[model samples]
Target: MKVAIYTLGCKVNQYETQAMEQELRRRGHQVVAFEEAADVYVVNSCSVTAVSDRKSRQMLYRVRREHPQAVLALCGCYSQTHPEDVEKLDVDLIAGTGDRSGFLDLLEQAAAERRHIVALDRSFDHRTFEVLPAGGLESRTRCLLKVEDGCVNFCSYCIIPYARGPVRSLPLDKAAEQAAGLKAAGYREIVLTGIEISSWGQDLKDGKSLIDLLETVAAAAPGVRLRLGSLEPRTVTEDFCRRAAALPDLCPQFHLSLQSGCDETLRRMNRKYDTARYLQSVELLNRFFDRPAVTTDLITGFPEETEAEFEQTLAFIRACGFARMHIFPYSIRPGTPAAKMRQVPKSVKEERAHRAAAVAAELRKNYLEGCVGATYPVLFEQPKEDWFFGHAPNYAEVLVKGTDLHNEIRPVTITSTDGEFLYGTIKE
Candidate 1:
């Protein structure tokens, strides 16, 4: 069978899609591109926002229309949260966030019988983490190791908590074992990703935390560069920072989630931390690591967000000086609490997003300028035009003029920046 998968949303979705692809290939099925003809088409959907849900529907509709004869499957957050909507589509098989292996089994069964199958379980009933393969295809230099799944943080703007349920973590030993395997497989970097990595070990009842898991994985993969996914600001304490800083192979880049920097907006959003706590996390990372790249997410024009509140957010981001930022205009997600609140005008939302983006651009430029003249060991990934491109430990994209530098970690002395990427030369 020829199976093609189209993934949407966050890195966890990407990781799950890769795992499914590997499983299909292992079963002697050919995995094809979404644009190509196939016997089965899987749309791993995302419902983080209404726009994300729309895109998932668009992809599913497109695949169904283009390939009328193929078996269409819908899974992930969108289907998990809104199965009724997904059922209206011409999909042949439907599975929620859990049980990818079983979903594939149903796919085979549906293909054989030409029948419709729906397999979904209550999200809250889930207690164990679904362990999948850790790496991508052999050609990739970096792979993601999902150390945890699910979220209990029911922020007012999020639908993920309901879609993903409570935290269920991959055991420490299993994570270490996977890290060792990924290292042996010649992966240059292994990223620790999840729905909420900060909540790892909560379900284990072992009194261990994310830092413990990090130390274990670092020991398991001595030479592999370890990168982390988006973290809750509360996770960055003195103990966490100190232990994490001790890991020699850990990348000095942290992505702390900060939706709004204003205290009142944060209160309405039900965020666990305020601007002061978020700033402390940034400061702690900077103090522990040498100019560590601190990245964040910002939502502009949230429901009832006053102009003064937006200004406060801008000021707060400037104070933190993020290395990079993902700024979004607030979009109403139907099931989320923020959707029911007094809404901001769409024009105002977009305008605020533009302003926030301008600030983000300035901060990024400043951070990049600060990188000049510093030397970093860059892990080369691919070549473009006349240069091989890779990322430093700080996750800065660095380009050096070379050929066949893929998968090689070479010390690169930064010479300049074109305001977007760092141009450097290999320190032979």
Candidate 2:
């Protein structure tokens, strides 16, 4: 059978989809592009918000409409949380967030019998971590190694805690082995990604933490650069910074998750940390890594958030000086606690999003401009038109007019900026 996999949501989802593709290929099935004619269409869905759910439905329906003969497989967060909704879709196989191997088995069975199958587990009931292989089909500059799974942080606005279960980690030795294997496979960079990487060693009694995972992975990949996924603000401690800084391969970009900056809004959102704690984490990253690019996520117009509170958020983000920030207007998810609170007006959410976006743009531009005159070891990913696009250690996009720079790390000296990316020249 020919399989076409479409993934939605975070890097973990992408990694899992790649794992699925690998599994199918191992079973002697062809893995084709989604646009190509195929026997199966697997939509690894996301349900971060109402918008995400709608998008997941739209993608699945489009596949069903376009290729009626192909089997439709709906899985991931959307199918995990709202199985009934997914069952209503013209899907042949319905699998939840876990049980990838079982999902593949069911997919084969569904293909053979042309019958519908539902494979969902009580997400939180299973404490054992599901191990899936990392890396993908094509040889790429960066690969995501999911070292952790699930989140315990039941934030007011998130459905992920339910969609993904309690914290389960890939043990330290296993993580090191995976990293070594990915490095052996010729991947230049390995991104340690997960639902909540900060909560990584909580389920284990080995006294290992996120830093231990980082250090272990770093040591595993002798020459490969290591990048981290989004981190909870609470994870960036002085100890973490101090230890992580010593690892030469770790990238300097840190994405701290800060939904809303205002203390009152944070309390309402049930965030574990306030602006002060978030700032402390940001400061520690800066203190340890030289000119580290600190990025963050922000939600505007949260439930019952006053304009003054929004302003406080704006002021707090400006103070953080994030290199890049993703700001989204609040979207209510049905099962989350924030959805039950007095909702903020859509107009207010839109307005605040725009305002915050403007500030974020300015900060981004400044960060790019600040890169001028700096020489960085950039891992060149691909070349397009007149330039080869790559990323510096801080995850800054560095573009150079060059030929065949793919998968090559070169010394790039940033000489100019176009307000979006830094144009640089590769030093011979």
Candidate 3:
């Protein structure tokens, strides 16, 4: 069977899609592009926002329309939260957030019998981690290793906790082994990803934390650069920063999840930390690492977010001066508490999003300019149009004109800035 996978949303979803493709290939099935007609079309969907939900449905309809005879399967957050919704799309096989292995089996069976199959369980009932393959689609410089799954944090605006479950971590040894495998496979960088990585060690009875797993993976794959996915602010303590800073291979970029910057808004959204604590986390990282790039996500126009509150957020963000930021206008998810709250008008949301983005743009411009005249070690990933693009240790996208620099670490002298990216030259 030839399979084409269309994946949407977070790094974790991308990791799972890659795993599914690997399984299909291992089972002697050909994995092809989604545009090409194939025996099966797997849409690993996202439900982060209404837009994501619509995109999932849109992809399902288009794929089914394009390849009328092909078997269509839908999985991930959108399908997990609403399997009935996916079933209505006339998919041949349907599974939720869990059990990728079983999903593949059912997909095979569905293809063999030409039957529709729906397999979804209560996401909250899931307690065990579903281990999937740890690498990427491209056999290249960087890969992702998902060491955790699920989120217990019931943020007022999020549907992920319901879609995914409580925290389930990959055992320390298993994480180490996966890192070793990725290193052995010639991957130069490994991004530790999950639904909520900060809650990694909560389910464990033994004394273990993300730092412990980080130490194990760092030692296991000394040659590979270790970067982390979005992290909760509470994880960056003095002790955590000190230990993590000692790891030579760990990348200095820290993506702290900051949904809102106003204290009142944070309370309304049920965020675990306030802007003060979040700033402390930012400070800790900067104090520990040399010019660590602090990045974050900010949501604008929550219910009851007054213009004054929005101003506070903009002020707070400017204070932090994030190197990169993902700013979104709050989208109401039907099942979440935020949906039923007093709504902000869409026009207000858009206005605030633009306001927040302006601050973000200014911060990004300053951050990029700050890199000028500095030297950075970049792991070259791919060469395009006579320019090689890679990332600095702080996770800044660095583009330099070079030849044959693939998978090699080279110091690049930063010469120019493009607001969000740095243009540099390989030091002779």
Candidate 4:
């Protein structure tokens, strides 16, 4: 069978799609491109917001309309949370967030019998983590190791907790083993990713936290660079900073989730921490690592967010001086609490997003300028035009005028920046 998968949303979704592709290939099925003809088409969808949900629906509808004869399967967050909507699409097979292997079995069955199959369990009833193989198909430079799954944090603006259930973590030993395997497979970097990586050890009851898992994986893969996914601000404590700083191979880039920087907006959003605590996380990272890149996510014009509140958020983000930021205008998710609250006007949301983006751009320029004189070990990934591109430990994209540098880590001395990429020369 020829199977093609189209993934949408976060890195976790991309990782899951890769795992599915590997499984299909392992079963002697040919995995084709989504554009090409195939026996099966999978839409690993996302529903982070209404926009995300719309995209998922559009993709599914297009696939069904284009290839009416092929078996169409739906999985991931969108289908997990809104199965009724998905069922209306007449998809051949529908699987939720869990049970990848079983989902494949149903896919095969659906293809063979040409029957509609819906295999979805109550997400909250799941207690164990569904472990899947890590690594990408063609890319050897970097791979994602999903150390945890599910989210218990029921923020007012989020529906992930309902879609993903409570926190279920991959065992420490299993994570280490996987890290070692990825290292042996010649991967230059291994990223620790999850639905909520900061909540990694909550279900284990072993008292081992994310720092412990980091230590174990670092030990297993001595030379592989270990990068982390988005973390909760509360996860960054004095002890965590100290322990994480001790890991020689850990990437010095921390992405702390800060949806809004205003206290009142944060309270309305049901965020666990305020701007002060988020700033402390940034400060702690700066204290422990030399010029560590601190990145974040911000949502503007959330429900009932006043202009003063938006200004406060801008001021707070300026104070924190993020190395990079992903700014989004607030979008309503039907099932989330924020959707029912007094909503901000769409125009206001977009305007606030634009203003926040301007501030973010300024901060990014400042951060990039600060990287002018430093030297870093850059792991080269690909070539473009006359330059080979890669990323530093701080996750700064670096370019050098060179060839044959793919998958090679070399000492690069920063010479300049065009407010976008750091241009450097490789030191022999």
Model 1, span 384-428: residue lDDT tens = 888899999999999999999989999999999977899999998
Give the higher-lDDT candidate: 2 or 4: 4
The model with the greater TM-score, 3 or 4, is 4
Q: Give the per-residue lDDT digits (tens) of candidate 2, residues 52-76.
A: 9999999988998999999999899
| True lDDT of residue 207, candidate 1 | 99
TM-scores, each model vs. reference: 0.99, 0.98, 0.98, 0.99
**lDDT for position 270 in model 3:** 95
lDDT per residue (tens digit) for residues 24-141 in model 3: 8899999998888798999999999888999999999898788899898998899888776777788888889999999999999999999988898889999999888888665578
Span of ten consecutive residues with least summed lDDT in model 3: 131-140
Count backbone clashes in candidate 4.
Answer: 0
Looking at candidate 2, the ten consecutive residues that score lowest on lDDT are 133-142
Deviation from truth (RMSD, Å), model 1 = 0.8
Residue 37 displacement in candidate 2 (angstroms):
1.0
Cα deviation of 410, candidate 4, in Å: 0.6
Q: In model 2, which runs have C-alpha deviations exceeding 4 angstroms? A: none
Candidate 1 wrong stretches, greater than 4 Å: none
